[model samples]
Target: MHSDVIKISDKDIKKPKGKVFVVYFSSISNNTHRFMDKLDVSDARIPYELNQELIVDKEYVLITPTYAGGGGDTKGAVPAQVIKFLNNENNRHLCRGVIASGNTNFGDTFAIAGPIISKKLNVPLLYQFELLGTQNDVESIRKILEDFWGEK
Candidate 1:
């Protein structure tokens, strides 16, 4: 088998209408970078910041590592930061899809980011992947993406 799984709601994972943006916000050295490497990109938030008010008419999937208070719920609630970003965009209709990625331990952290992404932007969580990071993080990621997009 060349597949995997992540629990998601019905609202998430819609086939987007236009071009897609794979936005990644990384802090912990290479985890974020390594993950992004396994995927293809039409465009990326490499600078990880967007032009103010540039409503992306294309679909988007966000992959961000959970940090700050640390893994899942420190009860720290930094998920609001993502909401703030969406609020700043003020273009809910522009987002046709949503996704998040983080270490498997902080499962709830990124999981929480999903609904908030939906509520804040009124979008949907297309899917999310949590990595415990085995001996081969790259291969783990490749398997997951292969499962999701059925590409490479």
Candidate 2:
């Protein structure tokens, strides 16, 4: 069976309506942090910082990694800290979408955090990539962000 993934180039990605905030957590392998670096844009912050002040406005995308267990035995779920940060009612409105990361070894549970966040937060699960991601993954993510943030 062929993968149904569509290949999008950097040229295809458009400019944003405004700024796009990338919120991520990198506690374990830090692969998600590495992936964010490849994006090469500066509008990013950690969840802890945002919690200090309720950000009721602005467009943001969550980029987080799935933990081995959801702080316990539930594998492939969003970490507790991330959930706490997002739980703030004010922060919920600012989130436009999500991009999740996980290890492929997790199999079907890989990057499951993205789906949970997207559903609970009422946003789209923009992308889910393996740890650190690949060159194509970076470019594709750029395109998705650009398109999502474009005039609309």
Candidate 3:
């Protein structure tokens, strides 16, 4: 095990410093986790549990997978545990970023999870990106994260 940390000069710190959190439901494609890991933010990829403290945090990027007949959507269901976690009142005022994973075969299968996350996060939707790949999706996701976070 190892610790990874990078320190920037004071000049760099002046540009809107904020924490990042990822509310992920399922990482079947691992694209979300890959992006979050690249972000280097203290995050939680709970395909199971979420709590009030999660909402209180300011910088959050929630990623949820779309599903229908049992696949990316977690057995064709919207993991109620995550929904309950979002329903918390403390989660309001969250800064937004989103990444959705789904099959492009469906019209909007890969991009609809953001609204639900936005409502709960109470954020203005900073950016949303989608990824659709069978096994190579993770590599493509890294580029998207770089484009998203590297932007001014």
Candidate 4:
């Protein structure tokens, strides 16, 4: 099936209104949280210790970090908190896309969570970046979100 999720590229230069709603899960290291802070979009952070399920009322992009097991195993790559958040049917339905973060040192598993979630949820993997991302990553993602949501 054709997907509406926008794929970001270098050519997308629209100005972002910072209106896109982002939902993310950041581990204790806060790599994902730190990355989200750099972007101007509205966001909610999924607590590492989730006591209640989160339900997103509107469409959003999910940003999460990879947590691959030892020995370069892909298992447990997607954070448990992220899995819990996505367990809700409403939240799953509203997930427009995903952006994953990881360390390049992990090699083959770098940002693997993005692809896994994208396939499971049938949404696009909008982007992936190393820990905290760069200034270019922030600017590009903001612009892409604006263009995708037609808030440019």
Off by over 4 Å in 1: 1-15, 28-30, 46-57, 68-84, 90-92, 107-110, 131-152
Clashes of each: 4, 0, 0, 0
Residue 19, candidate 1: alpha-carbon lDDT: 43
Between candidates 2 and 4, the TM-score winner: 4
Q: How does each model score on lDDT?
A: 0.49, 0.69, 0.47, 0.78
Kindly list the per-residue Cα lDDT of model 1 for residues 1-152, writing each as its tens digit.
00222344655655454443565555446566666666545545433334433344455556554443344353433234344455545434556445555544444454455444545555555555664333354465444444444455
* Structural similarity to truth (TM-score) of each candidate: 0.55, 0.76, 0.51, 0.84
What's the C-alpha lDDT at position 133 in model 2?
Answer: 93
Among these predicted structures, which one has the highest TM-score? 4
List candidate 3 stretches off by more than 4 Å: 1-17, 27-31, 34-40, 47-56, 69-78, 119-152
Which candidate has the highest lDDT of all? Answer: 4
**lDDT of model number 4:** 0.78
Tens digit per residue, CA lDDT, model 3, 50-82: 443344455455566655332334233244555
RMSD of 2: 6.4
Pairs that collide, model 4: none
Ranking the candidates on TM-score from highest down gives 4, 2, 1, 3
Evaluated at residue 112, the lDDT of candidate 2 is: 76
For model 4, residues 1-152, the per-residue Cα lDDT tens digits are 11323454545423223358899998888777788877967888887787856777878888899887435578999989999999888888788778888888887788888888887886777788888999999998887677767785
